[model samples]
Every structure is written in C-alpha cells, then in structure tokens.
Target: MRPRADAVLSEWFGPSDGRLLAVPMSLRGKVVGVLLALEGGPGLNVAMVQQLTYTVGLMLETLASRPNVPTPALTPPEVISGEPEVAVEAPPAVPEEAPRAVEEVSVAAVEAPPAVGDGSETVQLKMPIAPAPPAAVGRAPEDERKHEEARRFARLLVSEIRLYNEQAVQTGKLTRNIYSHLKEDIDRSREMYEQRVSAEVRADSNYFHDEMVRILADGDADALGV
Candidate 1:
C-alpha cells in the first residue's frame, strides 16, 4: 500500500496535475486518513511525508477531542470559503460642535504724529509687528557623543544582521536545499529589531551630539579660567 501510494505521489509530477504530492492525515498519533495528492511534481520526500503525517495526526487529535456542537451552516458557503473571516469594530464617535475657550490678546494704542515743519497735515500709521519665532535649541555635547555611538552601533548591527542572513541562506541551501519557516522568522525578527533601533537612534541623535559639545565647552571654559 505504501509503495503504491508513493508511486501515485510521484505521478503527481505530471504537467496536467497541480495538486499536493502527499498529505497524510492522522488522529491521536495514529494514521486515520491518507490524503494522496496527484498534482505537482516529483511527489513527497521522506521528510515532507513525515512532517505531513505528524501535522495530520495533531489536527485529527484536536478534532476528535473537540465537543460536537452543531455549527450554524454558513449561508452561501462559497462566499465564506473565498474570503477569510475577520471582525472589524466600528471607530469611536466624535462630538460635533466641541466646546472651545476664547483667548484675549492685548494691543498697544499709538498716539497720532505731530504736524510737519511746513504745517502740512501728517498722517501716521502704526502696524503691529509680530514677535520672532524661537530658534531651535541645539543638542548638548553628551547627546552628540551618544548619537555618534548609536550610529556606530547601528552600522555594526546592520553588518552583523546581513552577515547572519547570508550565513543562514548558505546553511539552508547546503543542509536542506530549501529555506525553512524558522529561518524566515529569524530574519523577520532581526529586521523588525533593526528598524526599532534605527528609530531610536534618529530620535535621540541630536541630543547625543549636543552632550559631547557641552562637555568640550565646559573643558574650554575651565582652561581659560586657569
């Protein structure tokens, strides 16, 4: 039976078929059903077969233990199958015509200008001048040093991540001839971590440089006093 199943799985390599090679379904650590696929190429390898068998077994065990409950038959079953099930909650409502407090501003009154020397009538116009915007505060010297350190660390981290990714790819190619989900997960985690670190570096970079400058300024001031 196993040999015939294997042969059938191998036959799945035919161009006409586009199905899975083999799917072994199990229940309670035992083979309850064998899903022999007749699509796709070259059939299942020993490892794939083993993994599939295990996965099937786990699923069957769960189903077997689950209490039998009459599930509501979905109306238009095809629609349910075509689209994934997801619940979206409505966003909170905002109040209309929100209350607002009024702000009062004071304006200085200007006196009229005196008549000109020729006794001709003079008109004086006063325009309110706006205050200058505050300058952006500079970072401290210690902050500057920290920024530099962070930049250096970030570079090192990126280099290490690339190196590790390359190593993982090479290792997968040599040992398994295919990259596994575990390797993909590791790569994803590393990428996310790097992004987070980069954000932190950008946010604090200016302050880091400022701190270094402050330290240097203090040293110079002390030297001048001496």
Candidate 2:
C-alpha cells in the first residue's frame, strides 16, 4: 500500500488496507470535530455513513448543551474594592439591684360570747373593702347613648364621602391644586353642622370632621356631574 494524495485523509492517517470513513462531528450546523471509522468486515455504505453521522452529531449537540463549558455571567462583576468591614459588638448588660424585704401582714380573729345558754362559740365576721366604680359609671346613660349614636352617624358619613370622592375623581373635576380650598369648605360645613345640629344629634369632634368630608365630596360630585 502507498500514501496517495487523491485518497480521503491519506497523508494524515498513513496508508491502510481497509476503507476509511471520515464523518464530521457538528453542533448547530458548525463542524466541531471529525469522526474516523475504519470498516473491517464490509466496505463503507450510505446507510452506515448516515447512521454514524447522525449519532456523532447528536453527541456533539448534547455535549454543547451541558454545563461543562465555563461561561461569563451577563451581570456586572462585583467589586471587592471597598472599606474594610468592621465587626459590630453587642452592648453590655446592666446589673440588677438587690430585692427589698417584704413586711408581714397580721390578721386578727375575735370570738364572741354566746347570748343565753345553749353554749355554742360565735365568731365575729369582717367585711372586705369594695373596689371603686369605673369611669363610665360616672357618665349619665342618656349621654352615653347619644355619643354612641353620633359615632355611628360619623362612620356612615365617612362611607358616603369615600363614595362621592371616588365618583368626583373619575369625572376629572377634582384636581390637586384646589384640595386646600375644598378642605376649608369642608371645615366651614362641619362648623355649621355642629352649631345647628348639636342639640338634635349629640356627637364628638370626629363626627363633625366626617360630616365636613361628606359635604365637600357631595359638592364636588354635583359640580362634576358625577
């Protein structure tokens, strides 16, 4: 056998008796390496060449997809260039003071003499001190009832204001610039409500505030057609 330039990879592998097959190992249509197969029993055919080419291509593609290759992260590399970190120390605990001695309480029991003659020992009973009544007990029930009703009304007023404001905002008539003016109007409305309705409906300061918010919201909604 002689080395021939006309043959496939002749000079690289030297002269051989059997037929040689050179298949390209590729990934994504790019050639990565070459697969060399020497046919021992039979001559190389089209079916054998196709099978070998497909198997080698799949292996190369799998290897390329694996995490074996080292890749740079897309994010900016972190810099260790900064001031040296200082270790934080916890605060020292305070020493506890010595406990004071407790004074002993004395309880006296007295026995009373039997009044005529059956002769049974009678014991004198001592009554315990009663606790003082709560602060609410000092307030009249009628006033408390009125205050509760006022609080409930105030909460209702708040709900109404929220609904009206939502509608006003949707209509685009309410702007941030006139918020202070609206607030002033609300305050005026609350003062008027308090002066006129104080006798009819007993309420707290919060009740007047809620009423003011409601009045402003209603006025804005009416102007906006919302």
Q: With candidate 2 superimposed using the best TM-score fit, by how many Å does residue 185's alpha carbon deviate from the native?
A: 6.5
Hey, what RMSD does candidate 2 come out at?
Answer: 45.7
lDDT of 2: 0.40
lDDT of 2 by residue, 1-226 (tens): 1123235446665665555444444333344444555556566453344333443333333333333433433453344555785444544544444333222111112122332322222323221111222345556787665554554444333333333343343343454323343444444544554554466444333555433333333433344222
TM-score of each predicted structure versus truth = 0.22, 0.24
Evaluate residue 15 in candidate 1 and report its C-alpha lDDT on the 0 to 100 scale. 33
Which pairs in model 2 have colliding backbones?
Answer: none
Write down the TM-score for model 2.
0.24
Please give me the total number of clashing residue pairs in predicted model 1: 19
Off by over 4 Å in 1: 1-31, 38-43, 70-226
- Find the 10 residues in a row with the least total lDDT in model 2: 102-111
Q: State how far residue 182 of model 2 sits from its true place (Å).
A: 3.8
- The C-alpha lDDT values of all candidates are 0.35, 0.40
